[model samples]
Target: MTTTDMLTGALAAAARGWHVFPLLPSTKRPARPNHRERDCTGTDPRCRAGHTGWDARATTDQTRIRRAWSSNNPSYGIGIACGPSGLVVVDLDTHKPGTEIPEPWNRFGIRTGEDVLDHLAGARGGTITPTYTVRTPSGGTHLYYTAPEGVRYGNTAGTIGWLVDTRAHGGYVVAPPTTIGSSSYVVTDDRPAAPLPLFLLDLLKPQRHTTSAAAPKRFDARTDRVPAYVASAIKGEVAKVTSAGAKQHNHRLLCAAIALGQLVAGGVLDERTAYDALTDAARVLMARGCDCTPIEVDRTIRSGFHIGSRNPRTPGTTRDNSRKAA
Candidate 1:
């Protein structure tokens, strides 16, 4: 596409209330540079006080959009920041060479990412609703779905199903008319973005111990409702809460309670046991001499637990890492 087309596309996206940014000319990468704090010399105006990444610099204000896209590089392509736009764009990717579809999906003859998503939707007793869809230059599809109210999802790679990825918070997608060489990403479906399906949102729900606890501990309720694996998760989460930094103490405690509370809802842990574990863990914060009182800590924990109990996540739903990158 030409400069005029790129600029117009950006303005159009901004008009739709989606924050837009300029991608590098003839490329999918962002045109704006992301400065790092340790590498900062404090000379540049944007990073004078601290670092500012491309995501933060994204804007929808007409004046700023015009200035940014028209400045040194008018040929820049359009990019939509999915988070600010309240979007969770599911990337149905085409399988590249040297890749193979894993089992379950493989047995069903699932070839591309679209097929994987379709299969997943079917398994969940639903269908892919009509929404704004963009066809990538590589024969893949970008299904734009509005994120749930007050919920934030992050970028996932092959987690939902084989070849299926999602871009939400901390991610961006090249918009239509953004060309890669001679091929351009085109909007195949012009419908309004649909609300992300509830089943889909549960699949994207994030766990607090992405670093500390790698996976959800699995167990068979037939033999034992609460196994030693669940015990480990509890210990890890409690450790995170008690050892959290001064500002993070309350938040961490709440998150831990919520996580354990999910297990309680799923019948994997006793509610009383989970509460007692977390309450004892919160005592560590008090011992560390934080301003927090017993009542406030108890309230935060109870609130978080109740919130989590509302959305029960069964243990071992997040299995099959081997199938990732399929």
Candidate 2:
């Protein structure tokens, strides 16, 4: 994407009062490096000034966005800080070729993140309240809603369901028209964001501590969404495995396996696809001088993946922690 294209999209969001920042060129990772407090060398350029993270540094000023992403600088992608934007975005996602929705969701034939949200909304005796929305490149959606005044909701991971997530306080989202490879996030609905409905707002609140998993306070059985963002991650991780040094060969492959496992649990990628990809990468790495054999690699992947499935995850997406699933 061109700097001009990014600038225009950033301006559009900022004009709507959504604070924006620079993501890395073609990535969701922030362009603004997060300075570590422990390494605050006070004099180092990266840490010389008081540390200002992406969320804190995000702005609504058109000039700031333009200057940061102009021709003189990298043609950075756009990130909208959800909290500052006063938005609570329901991130509905699709699944990868090799993943399946978990437990209860799968039992109900629920596949996408959108389906989960819709099912819950129906259970709550309500319909989805449409607002400003962004559609991610992988067929997922970002349903933007106005946050309630004075409530700071943080990011969540599968707390809503198998593939659904939310982005709020302490989180950011890749804004529309930000390209990654050939695809880009684009605005599907440019209308003003609707105020978050009470039902959903309540879901984002502190859920009561319970002995057992509790059904969300106001959910029904009408969910209709899914999630899928593993395309680049798989390719990247596999590439890493194939290029890893001897000291990190097995470790890198294991890590990649575990990461893919988390996505499998999150319904973002299928188990078989994740396994085969890792196995193939491992075999290639082995052929390239690493001593690891196919059997050993398979076992390593399985072990790491088992550990990861317990905790579902999202990658480079706006993750919201709504109430935990029952």
Candidate 3:
């Protein structure tokens, strides 16, 4: 499409209260540089350079939108910032590599966008509610929904099965009428973006509390001793493993290993102690009918420990912790 057509589509999107920004021609990346040679590239928005990113440049203002598109690159594609636009787009991808398909489609039924929609519809009593949908340049579909009030949903990659992604807060999606290669993103359903269904909303909700098992704790060790928080976190992981189902047993064990590795790297737990503790923890699961082999447990712990040792918990500390010992 021509530059005028692209700008017109952008302006039209702006009219729909979607905060629009200019993308690099035929690409999903922003048109502006995120960091200049001399400017601060920190998280501080006030110190950012001019139009450094899509989130900063994204706006609904007609004048600003026009200026952004009418510049040297009029052929630039349009991008809509999800949060500002009050949108949560369910990106049903079709381009995932064959090796990455979680389930064997030949054995189990192939999951498609239609199947997902059907499942949602079935949960809501057989009526698949209509909303604004976009057909991407690829065979994938972008299902747009009005974001839940007051809650900011962030972008999630591969969180919802394989071949599915979400574009929400801090995320931007290419607007319709933008062509990439030979294909174009076109509006399939021209209706307004509908409110996200309750069932889907529940799935999208941020998991806060410890439901089935205790949540994994992030490693933060600034003091010489392993903090109470770190100890408690390890305990929680152990508890999760002991109580985890057969399906979750391996994952919970891996998480515990990683945590123990972090503690070892931070000088909280010695290497031998970490290994013994992890082995004992795994034993608890094995006693409770968990099917994880001893070899898998040892391998998981060793791999995690190696990684944590390389990137120690202490900030700015070298890979070698001998200096601290000295």
Candidate 2 lDDT, tens digit per residue, 1-326? Answer: 78898898889889999999998887889887644656565664545567667887899887778798788887889999999899888899887778755788778978888888877754542335546788998889999988868778898878977678899998888988899888999888776786664347547786521111222122111222223246666776788777888788878877777666666555455455566677777766655667766657756776555555555676654422321211
What's the distance in Å from true for residue 79, model 1? Answer: 1.3
What's each prediction's TM-score? 0.61, 0.61, 0.56
Candidate 3 residue lDDT tens string, 30-114: 7765555356555545344432556766888998877877745659888999988999988887744565445543244556655
The deviation in Å at residue 190 for candidate 1 is 1.1
- Model 2 spans > 4 angstroms off: 34-37, 43-49, 206-326
lDDT digits (tens) for residues 1-326 of candidate 1: 77778878889889878999888877888876644657777677777777776787889999888887674566888889998999999999887878766898768877899888766654543335557889998899999988868887899999999889999999999998888899999989786676675347547884321111122232223325358778777777888887899798877887776677666545556555566567667766666677776667656765565555544656665422221211
RMSD of each: 15.6, 21.6, 18.7
Quantify all predictions' global Cα lDDT against the true fold: 0.73, 0.72, 0.66
Worst 10 residues of 3 by lDDT: 208-217
Model 1 alpha-carbon drift over 4 Å, by segment: 34-38, 206-326
Show how many residue pairs clash in every candidate, following the order shown.
0, 33, 0
Q: By the lDDT metric, which is better: model 1 or model 2?
A: 1
Regions of candidate 3 where Cα sits further than 4 Å from its true position: 34-52, 95-100, 104-106, 120-128, 206-326
